[model samples]
Structures are given as structure tokens and as C-alpha cells.
Target: MQSGLALLLIGIQLVYAGKHSLQYFYTATSGLPNFPQFVSVGLVDEQPFTYYDSNIRRETPRQDWMAKSEGEDYWEQQTQTLTGTEQSFKNNINVAKERFNQTGGVHINQVMYGCSWDEETGDVDGFDEHGYDGEDFFSLDLKNLRYISTVPEAHITLVKVNNNKALLEQKKQYRTQECIEWLKKYLQYGKSTLERKVSPEVSLLQKSPSSPVTCHATGFYPKEVTISWQKNKQDHDEDVDLGELVVNEDGTFQKTSTLSVKPDDWKMNVYECVVEHKSRTIRSILTEDKIKTNYAPVPIGIIVGVVAVVLLLVIIAVAGYKVYQKNKGFNPVNASDDGSNSSAHSDPKA
Candidate 1:
């Protein structure tokens, strides 16, 4: 569909803020309309950490220039910024009688780079990537750009040459500042629905709401949203149980916050679920009806679920009892055997 293609052209948008990470990918695949044509497709994050296209405000390839053109800047940036020794990879791919040398190419090459960090501490939380060999696994320090890639070639050329140090410094700059601007610009141009906040669908769930009320807020955007329980316009933290933010299928996020209320508070329905988001601040009452939001009867559902579990356990117990009964008789000591032996000895005299 034209609409889907339009979305694809804008590149993939993912919530890097969820885990506070930025991943880079370097790839080459033959078999295109123009075999060696270069294209950028963003996935696993909001936008590519850096931009190199005709429309964006950056050093794009010149109108008459190509990716492999002599004295170019794109692939060199790819090699230096992320992959220090990519030239060797190109040489191997384009070796004699390969796709680069043939009319129809049949080779695919790719490298993935990823790291996680805490925004507040600015310390290295985690880092890893796929190297270019059989033993091509790497763990890295995002803060200082210290890395230990398993590939022997990568160790010799990249880590020894201090390539990751430069790459990390630049990556932080682009990810925090440039990446944000690019996402806004692209989303605005594409008329992306991401701009609209599909207000959080607050549902009161769990077996008990008054005793331990659960307010699940789903289908919210920007991931900067907040959920809490309040009573009489005051922040309520009584027996509160907070949950982590989780991603949803449709690119939005969901989270739950549970609050345990006193018996009287439950009867009076003096509680509300408050959702604070970039778009709006809204609240849903934790009334009796909302408490029944789980739809199925709480007592019935719990009773049925528990019965099923108990029934399963009983079946297992009965099965074990039958097996014990069957095996208990396997080595029986017969009472008649001793008496029969005595009788045979007594008859020997006759």
C-alpha cells in the first residue's frame, strides 16, 4: 500500500528511552534495482543516530556523488564512527569474481552495534555487538569506549587503535541532540499518528481493588507518562505497589500501579487513578463499577482458577498412589511358601 510505503520511507521509530539504549547497524545487501545503490532504513530505534540524506540538514552525498565514489565521506563515516576496519570487509566482498565484480550480485553483509546506559549517572550500563567472524561477540563500556570484541581482527585494528573511544563520544552527542530533532521533523512531515496521544485506557483490574486496587494505564505515548493513586486530592501511597513501564504491540506503552485502601475507603469509594502525560492530566475514579472492571466476577474467577489448580494436583496425587499400589506387589513374600517347605521335609521320611 502507498500508505505503508510512505511509513517505511520515513524509517522505523522505536522507544530507545525504554531501556536507554542506542543501537547502530552497518549492512550491505546485493540484488536491488541498481545493484550497488545505497539506502538507509531505520529500525530498533526512533531515528538513526546520524543522518546522511539529501533532504535532511546535514552533509548528504553530493548530487553527482555515489556511496563508493573516490574522496567521499559517507562510508568512511560508517567505518570510522562505528566500524573502524570496514574497508577490509568491502575488499573481501568485492574480491575477484564476487558480486561487486559480477553482473548479478549474491552477497549480504551486516554488523549490529548496541549499548545501554543510565541517563543520570552517564556510566556504562552495558554494551555488545556482532563482530565479523565466528568468534564475533563483544562487550563494551559506553562511557569510556573501552571494548572487548571477540573477533581477533577487530581487537587488532579497532580496540588497539582506540576507534571505539571516538565513536562513543560522537554517538552520545548525536543521540541526545540530533536524533531528537530528526524524529520530530520526520514525524511531522509524515503526519505520523505518534503525535496524537491516544489517552491512556485506564482499567481497574485484579481480584480485589478496595483491598489492593490495580489501575492499569495502557496505550499512552512519549513514555514520559506517570500513573498514581490519590485520595481527597492528596497523593496516596498506602500499601501501594508500583510496576514497571512496558511496551505495547502498537508502539505505545503500558504500566500498572496498585493501591490498597482501608475497608471504609473502599465502601466510600474515595479513591482515584491519576494519569499525568505530556498531552493531558486525567483521572479515573476507583468506584465499585471500576473495581468490577476486570469484567469476570472476582470470587468466581479466583475460585475456578484455584479449583483447576487443586484438581490438577489431586489427579497427580491419585496417579502416584496408583503407581505405588502397582509396584508394592511386585516382590510379595507368600505365607504358603514356608508351610509348604515344612510339609515337604516331613513327607521325606515316608
Candidate 2:
């Protein structure tokens, strides 16, 4: 009996494991000069693979595998679908402006929707939500088959969205069924690129002798990694700051963990930074020889000039949307016809 129970529990655990996801983000902006009026991005496993904007007026693949796998017909269809969505979102921004009683000065409307599939158990789930001006607008409650309004202004939208029973059913079916199918197809096409593993390059950095020692890892694929510190062969967590994972332009990820210790204490005790990713483990000893510092005998003028250039580039990147924010929302807009027109789908071929 115990064996049977253990088997059942293992099966249950397997049902929720090995999950993969596909997500889409749509954004529309008004009063933002010299920027695309509409933008849409598609991601698999949190890595963006496809992008479209009003300025480009075409669907382009961000990953080389995607471009190689999909043909011109697929790109053309995707472009057409997103172009229609772009116009719908533009109109939505206008309607949202009316609701907010604003003539307008830089407003945004954003929508995020996606589905997740458990490969081990064939279980699937999905979500759809919208935001306006960096705040939640409304979302679909798939379990209850209802619309949830996050703010008072979204109540009307919620009612209008929920009133269409047929559309609601269609949306649910698409998310739970069609979406998962497309995700699987994409996984197959990009398996080589998506499933490949690349180990990280580890380094220790310090700004000055008095500063905390930082263990940095970069160029790692799959994004699942852990960085920890050990003191004298024992786990050390106190006074340690873990940085958020950042994706490099090349699609690999980077992370950092900083450990604070007095000079005398670290010199006396053996300290190490351990990083674990996939089936590999890396250990870096914290020593004066391993620490790279910016306080070297560099000219102050050169340092100041480099810092200024970096700051200017950062500002321009932020203004130009070179780095997309997942939670960003623009001004609210009332969607038409259950907002179905705003949704984009994968090519029906194959």
C-alpha cells in the first residue's frame, strides 16, 4: 500500500514538472514622438524569438533558428496578423483616452497573454491580461470563464468582454489548445538552439579593497543557475547580495552574487563562490589574486569620459525602447469585440 501511494505522489509531481511556456506582448503608444506606434513581441521560455513594429511593418525573427525554420509565407502571414492587431490597438488607445477624459500626452496600452505546457504530463494552462499606464486594467479568469476588472475604470471593459459567451469560449480554446500546439511546434523547430547548454564564464570583481567581493557569471544558457558563497567549506548566506538575472544581447544570461567580509576575516578564512548550472559546478576562491578592481592606476579623465558615454547610451536605450519592460502599460483603451482582434496567432500551416 505504501508503494502504491508513493507511486501516486510521484505521478502527481511529474504532472507539474518540465513545464515550457509561450508568451506574447503587444504595446501601443500615443504622443511618443519618433517611436513605433505599435509593437509586438513573441517569446518562448522567456526568450524573445519574434518581433514586429509599425515602423518595420513586417515580422522578423530574433533568433537565427527561427529565421531558418520559417519560410517567407510564414513571415508574411505573421506580419499581416500583427498589422491588423496594430490598428486595433491604436484605436484602443483613442477609446481609452476618451474614458480617462484626457486629450493625451504620451499614453500607452499593453497586453500580455500566454500559455504553459507540462511536457512530462501533457498538462496545459494559460493566462491573458492587460495593462494601461503601468497599471493593471483587466484580465481573463480562465477557471471561472469571467473577466476581472483591476480598477473601477476597467469595469465597463470587463462587462463588455464577458458578455460575449461565444468569443470567451473561443479565446479559452485557443489558449489551452491551439496555443500549446504552436508552442510545441516552435519547440521542435528551434530545439537545437533552445535546448543547447553553454557554461558560464566566472569572475571575481571588487571596486576597492573596502568593497564587497562579487562573483559574476555570464554567457550561460537555459538561465537556471545558482550562485552561493562558502566560508571555510561551509555555506555562508549573511551579508550576501544576489543580483537579478540579466539577459545579454546574445541571448545568454548573467548573474552576480556579492559577499561582504572584512579584509582580515576573508584573509584568515577560506572563502569560495560556487556556481551550479545544469550538470556542471564551478568554484572560485576569493583571494587577492582573483579579484579584478577598477581602482587600478587609470587616468581619471578617461574613467570620467567612459562613464559619461555609458550613461548617455543608457538614456538613449531607455528612450528608444531598446530594452523592453514586461510589465509596462500605457493609457487604457476600450477594446472592440471582446478584444479578439488584438490577438495574434501562429501560422496555421502544418
> lDDT tens string, model 2, 216-279?
8878887889999999999999989998665565667777898988878898999999999984
Q: Please report, as a residue range, the 10-residue window in candidate 2 with the lowest summed lDDT.
A: 315-324
User: What does candidate 1 score on TM?
Assistant: 0.42
Scored against the true structure, residue 343 in model 1 reaches a CA lDDT of 6
User: Model 1: how large is the Cα RMSD against the reference?
Assistant: 27.8
Residue range 165-212, candidate 1, lDDT tens digits = 444444344344444443334334333343445677777775644356
How does residue 126 of candidate 2 score in lDDT?
A: 76
Q: For each candidate, give its TM-score against the true structure.
A: 0.42, 0.78
